[model samples]
Target: MLKKYKDDQEFYSLVGIKPQTFYKMLEILKIAESKQKYYGGRKNKIVIEGRLLMTL
Candidate 1:
């Protein structure tokens, strides 16, 4: 299930979730361990990256 892209915004757009909710879901998935670098930005992009990783 490896994603074909590197942008998280694309992923969230495909999944239809708000950026905040997507971050929460990633936290619940236990994959937000290194989140400091991802704070304060278009989080949809970050979420997409996480989603791609999850798929992998």
Candidate 2:
């Protein structure tokens, strides 16, 4: 769903953030996700992009 918006204006309208900001936040989230310690439980159903979009 996040990939549906490519134009900056459209992406901003949909997510209330500029594409650059969104990508930056996505990168940060990916880094944090990678650094987390595994607890050996059920995995997340949503991808990082989806989670980020949902949080917006």
Candidate 1: lDDT of 40?
Answer: 54
Task: Show model 1 residue runs off by greater than 4 Å.
Answer: 1-14, 31-56
| True lDDT of residue 44, candidate 2 | 77
Per-residue lDDT for 21-47 in model 1, tens only? 755666666545346445654435455
Where model 2 places Cα greater than 4 Å from the true spot, the runs are: 37-41
> lDDT of each model, Cα atoms only?
0.56, 0.82
lDDT of 2 by residue, 1-56 (tens): 45666578988888899989988999999888867735445667998899988888
Clashes of 2: 0
Q: By TM-score, how accurate is candidate 1? A: 0.32
Query: What TM-score does candidate 2 reach?
Result: 0.80
